[model samples]
Target: MVDSTQRIRVGIGGWTFEPWRDNFFPAGLPHTQELHFASRAVTAIEVNGTYYSTQSPKSFARWRDETPDDFVFSLKANRFATNRRVLAEAGDSIQRFVESGLSELGQKLGPLVWQFAPTKQFDPVDFGAFLELLPKAVDGLALRHVLDVRHASFMVPAYLALARRYGCATVFADSDKFPSFADVTGDFVYARLMQSQPDCATGYEAETLARWADVARDWARGATPAGAPLVEPAHDSGAARDVFVYFINGAKERAPAAAQALIARLRTG
Candidate 1:
């Protein structure tokens, strides 16, 4: 059973970007203050920008210093690593990218996410080789490896088995095209509630948040009844107390507000 004492570490995707604010101040806040203010309320954050470009060690050091020691940062591995025009050609780039990000983030780094493009198909043999290379690629990095595969064909049982062998968690995405939480497998699950509107790709509603919280509570309690597939329990009492919910569906203006409301519900429950 899930321990009751754990506190769910909740976080949002990156900081807010306001065009109006950009117009007012050409330059963004200094790295130290920017991270400090952005992380004031949230205990964790997913570093999406890292997926596109490499960050300087100085910038990462500033980020490490600005946040509280307890805060965790989940970084997306660079796109070139996950989406290769030629798998063989991507080897050097992937190694360099992971090393650079880990070196910069230091102790604050949480998980390293590999988000594969939706167009990519699942090829067991090729994927198996790739998975074999992953552990060695990021050998010294102390971070969880998460796979976010958006293709419908990639959810096969064989793929899941490979993921299990590698100790990688599959991402649970609530979207029109992707499979729901019930279809995925992993010890450490990464769930993204992409929307509330039945048809919309973005924006989550109140009902959706409540439903997710219910699932999270069940996960924390480690109470999967008979006839159910076993999900990885929340790490421990400390890690299971609360669920980590990110507001990716809401508009830039509404995400923070939505996050606030969801946090309140978790606290009250």
Candidate 2:
């Protein structure tokens, strides 16, 4: 999806799901070709593997070469960086994660998502320090960060203000288990929709997919989607902003289908 200035991207969490080998990936498609095929199918993909372990610079370069020119990958930061009891002391871990060859992805890198556990409450001071530790750039390439805060305590004006101050995006998680809300706090919008169903052929019906397409468009134009749950007052800067919508944490098997369906709707408009 596009306007003259900004872009709207749709994707799934990762490319190597075994179920997708039969469901999303073509029959007999080589496992090694999954990224090649997936990169073509969706405009973006969240690199979930980065959350578990650090990848080599060669691996990042290979991923960059595997995808299309316009494709982008949003990486989930290492669990050790964000899953700590003390956020202020995570500077070293944060540095390690950013220094772990992410710059090799170059233009193909989208955003680095620092996801926190549900148990981590909103300690304004601690959270602020964590956000501060995120470097603005690495190896001359600009870095974009997205905070994935799951605790309900983060649903406050202070949290939004902090995020806006640092210009980091906050996740708009669409999950029943998390505090799912939409608040625009940065230069881009990052959403993780997690309600896809295994029964629906396309994960979501035409109506839902169409609605998401509309929401994504609104975000691209720098408007918060009307009727979206927001913790802070909606502000329209009227500046074009890139939007990333990933079908993540749902019935994982249907994420690819959901992403493809949303992409189809986005393309038609």
Candidate 3:
């Protein structure tokens, strides 16, 4: 069980575009090398590639070895499980994807993020059923399930309640299309700041990072500000109460700079 009242774990998205590669890692470094470099600064990573395809066991084994033991990898469940038009029909596919990853990632598996497409609307019955099925799917594995629903219709109080009931973390995405942190729910928070405009997206302003850091710190200590709902107790201690903030707003050239800045802020404070 994760201790919520402890230091917050900060990290960036796993895939970095070409332009920002040089700044974060030496030019022409291999993908694994880049991952190692990022791990040195940040303790967690959002594995975006799993959304496209399942990784082979051999590949996953190599990834586990490349990073330090304290590092955590948050995997995005494959698209077939998340982007489906018919939710119930995805059971087999979802099971297969989860099983494949679990075989390789073992204990290194962090949270399994299910990011539903924006076009999909919320169907309470279907969504609830889906959430109920998840715990059984990853039965023995010790990992957290995170929901990143993007539609405006899905941001209601009922939806958040369902997320908490199933013990899944609701992602707090800072995007124009989705609701912000004020309304999200969960014991563990996953924040992804996807950039829309060139100015705010390319790199985080000093104030922006500082503001987020403060929130992350407060959440870690189990002290929600007035009006914020108290987070449910998920673990014996609060050490695992992590704040995963990724900067997806930066241009390909600026992601490393933005990630580095955030990492520095978390460490210094």
What TM-score do all the candidates reach, one by one?
A: 0.78, 0.97, 0.85
lDDT of 2 by residue, 10-128 (tens): 99988999989878899999999999999999899999899999899999999999999889999999999999989989999899999999899899999999999999999999999
- How many steric overlaps are in each model, in order? 7, 0, 9
For residues 146-183, write the lDDT of model 3, one tens digit per residue: 88887877756677788878888888766665655544
- Score candidate 3 by lDDT: 0.70
Full ranking by lDDT = 2, 3, 1
Better of 2 and 3 by TM-score: 2
- Candidate 2 Cα outliers beyond 4 Å, as residue runs: 1-6
lDDT of residue 18 for candidate 3: 70
Winner by lDDT = 2
* C-alpha local distance difference test of each model: 0.62, 0.90, 0.70
Could you give candidate 1's per-residue lDDT for residues 153-212 as a string of tens digits? 775677777887887777766567665443334444466656634332224566766666
CA error at residue 137 for candidate 1, angstroms: 8.6
lDDT of 2: 0.90
Q: Between 2 and 3, whose lDDT is larger? A: 2
- Please list all clashing residue pairs in model 3, or write none if there are none: 3-237, 3-238, 3-239, 3-240, 4-238, 4-239, 5-238, 195-249, 201-249
lDDT of the structure predicted as candidate 1: 0.62
